[model samples]
Target: MRVRVDDASAGQRIDNFLVRVCKGVPKSHVYRILRSGEVRVNSRRVDQTYRLQLDDEVRIPPIRLAEKAAEPVVPFGKPFDIVFEDEALLVLDKPAGLAVHGGSGVSFGVIEQLRRQRPEAKFLELVHRLDRETSGLLIVAKKRSALTVLHDMMREGKVRKRYLTLVAGRWLNPMQHVKLALHKYLTEGGERRVSVNSEGKPAHSIVRLLKRWQSYSLVEVELKTGRTHQIRVHLSHLGFPLCGDDKYGDFSLNKQLEKQGFKRMFLHAAKLAFHHPLTDQLIELEAPLPPELERHVVQVEQTEEKEYG
Candidate 1:
């Protein structure tokens, strides 16, 4: 494969840049190629740590794969909401109750449907992920180059995501940060959950209260680490669970919400901000609350007003 460093990635390390550009190629093999001169920059062999300058031409030999690229293993459907799309990437507004990828007995998800929509697409990859119950902007890469770049950006904590949720308690503090350590473990049902632990991975979230009511509060959360259930578990542990969070909320309240037509969780991925993998330009994306969630919010507000009045 041949690649040229563009202006956006002018000052990155050569190996780092290469890793971003040559995704799905194993890291060990990538380094081996770099060490053995199979990979070259400007036609000269360089170490993995070599700093990359703008306009550097890199040449890499074809990799011998132990197995051919697999066929589409995921099943397909037709209900996909795309927010943005280009040759290099696609941004989707995934709805609540839909998984991003198939797992734990799920036959298909958003990615599967997307694959079916564009079967000829090569190197389609998920840049970041959202939980099955969380809905909003999801980034999908159409090429290996874009995938590698976006994944690197995610690892470096450059991707910014914001979620809007209705929590169970009244939050008087409009601006507050929720810092907690999260430990992940699988349940007997093979579902993932998190808990506060001293030896767990460090997780931080900045939560801002957007609105308040007698029984629930609408808040915006910014998660620093991509830990599973970090927001739900942390906020639950903090004594204010989400309004419709069945897994981490009062059972009676959840039952009440169910009666109120809240059929799904109230969490929503409201926005996404990241850098364009190919152009290095900043990208900001948004997804509005769906009808169900919107109605639930209005109902909760009305109920709260009645109780307080």
Candidate 2:
């Protein structure tokens, strides 16, 4: 089958376009076909990273798909809290436990639900991602032009992202800079994990102490370089693991805290600032700490006051 790329689908990577076009096809199979030169654009072979342009002719090879079971449905009634919106973008306060887009093992996620809610929306794509366990501000591009410019800004380090988190112990330094090289590896059980390695990608984070308790410290972290699991791995390596972080954290402490009703990850994406892709105006946004996390912080402060008073 062949498709002519339209404006709404322009600026998206070919692989993503194929994944969206081919219903019920596994992602690996789509990638395999692309690598094997089965997929073509304008009668020429293009790699997955090739972005589709308006009026480009894409040729898709037919594949036999197995009978798949019906997947679960996302609640169309529950829409994400929109923090900011214009013709170019949508900023959302993403809740924890929801994947950004469907893939891996998840069949549906925020993007899918958003598209379902607004079928008339021609172009919608994630600007960046947060781990499913982490919650906070997330950006979605409403236009292909917005997506392209925002992606360029990310690579140039023009976007400012900050997070709030509670660490396992009292932080001594008023400010700290962590520059760690992180390497990604698969566990024996096939689980993905990141660790600090000598030969790895360089990551930088600046952390500032916000408050201190006997057993935990609240801190704000600014990411200088974005890498998978960068914040969690860096803090864990410093012996100040994030409170309630399931991976790269203190497991025993997590279980103890869960029993005490502090069950979720303490990390939250509190702030985001970047220039508007179209207007070129600075866009600054913030999401107040979720009620649950705020309550936990108050409890810790109260306990410390009782002890020190």
lDDT values, one for every candidate: 0.82, 0.92
Q: Which ten residues in a row have the lowest lDDT in candidate 1?
A: 70-79
Instruction: TM-score for candidate 2, please give it.
Output: 0.85
Tell me, by lDDT, which candidate is best. Answer: 2
lDDT of 1 by residue, 1-309 (tens): 788876446666777766767766678888888889988889999997887787899897887766657654665565578888888898988888888877677877787778787777745668778888888888888766687778888877898989999888888887788778889888998877778997998888989999987778899999777788888888899888987776887778889878877878778889888888889888899999989989988888788778897
Instruction: Write one digit per residue (lDDT tens) for candidate 2, span 101-152.
Output: 8888998888989999999998889999999878999999998888989999
Total clashing residue pairs per candidate? 0, 0
Stretches of model 2 off by over 4 angstroms after superposition: 1-4, 12-19, 24-67
Pairs that collide in candidate 2 are none
Estimate TM-scores for all models.
0.76, 0.85
